[model samples]
Target: MEVAPQLRPRAGLEVVAGDVGEAVPSYAQAFQVVVNIEVKPVATVPRRTPGASEEADRLWLEHARTAAVIDDEGCFLVRGADRDWVRVRRTAHTALSAALVPGAGSMVIAMSPDGRRLCALTEEDDDYWIVVHHFEDPLM
Candidate 1:
């Protein structure tokens, strides 16, 4: 019996939207789909400030919830059931939440097409930007 040669699969694409509240104007949309973790309710904390994300950690660990925040350098997930603050880490996969860059305080979250890398929107000067990285496969 003879076997056929295998073919490579193609990557996926997606479009993401920023959180738009009732009072603020909206920003441009980002087209990406490498990694896409659900926007857990994340809480923001001061970068390098002492125990900044403690509150967010408390809620997540004690209550099992997530929050949306700009930066999450040293915060913990508040599960609402335990006293320990579950640590958060930068994913090798892609993420699209607002985060803190090295020196840019005002940067938008940019995800890779595959959802494996993370970057900032203001880092580039494009009208409609889409970060191309490794993303988590969605089960549909």
Candidate 2:
């Protein structure tokens, strides 16, 4: 995949605005696929921070729920029990509503087990970024 000129490794969290697709795999290599289920699209807003995604991965997963998989089309998908799917979808929607920028598009979303930290992969003008959102309080 061609990297967008504007997208470069930065110090803190990286942020973006818009839809993202197709490029997630390269960045999500360390994430193991937990399941594969069809997910409905939810409205998303583009927001970002400047930090190492690897760092977020470690911190987020230290207490994260099973990660939700976003497809090339930006829809959520998981391969697991019905309850797991429901939880992931619910968490995705709640996270989007609470933390995202408020726009029409799809993004990769992973929630902490406690439903507080949200890690989203978003794209804009062909450039992709990973943004992490930490809610002062839990969403549950």
Writing each residue's lDDT as its tens digit, candidate 1 over 76-133 gives 1211113111123333322221221334423333222222333332222212122222
- Least accurate 10 contiguous residues by lDDT in model 2: 78-87
Question: lDDT of all predictions, in order shown?
Answer: 0.25, 0.31
Per-prediction TM-score: 0.19, 0.29
Worst lDDT window (10 residues) for model 1? 2-11
- For model 2, residues 1-140, the per-residue Cα lDDT tens digits are 21222221221212223233332232232122211123211222223445333433333333233332332233332111221211222322223222222243323445343333445543332223444444464322
Local lDDT at 99 for model 1: 29
- For TM-score, the strongest prediction is 2
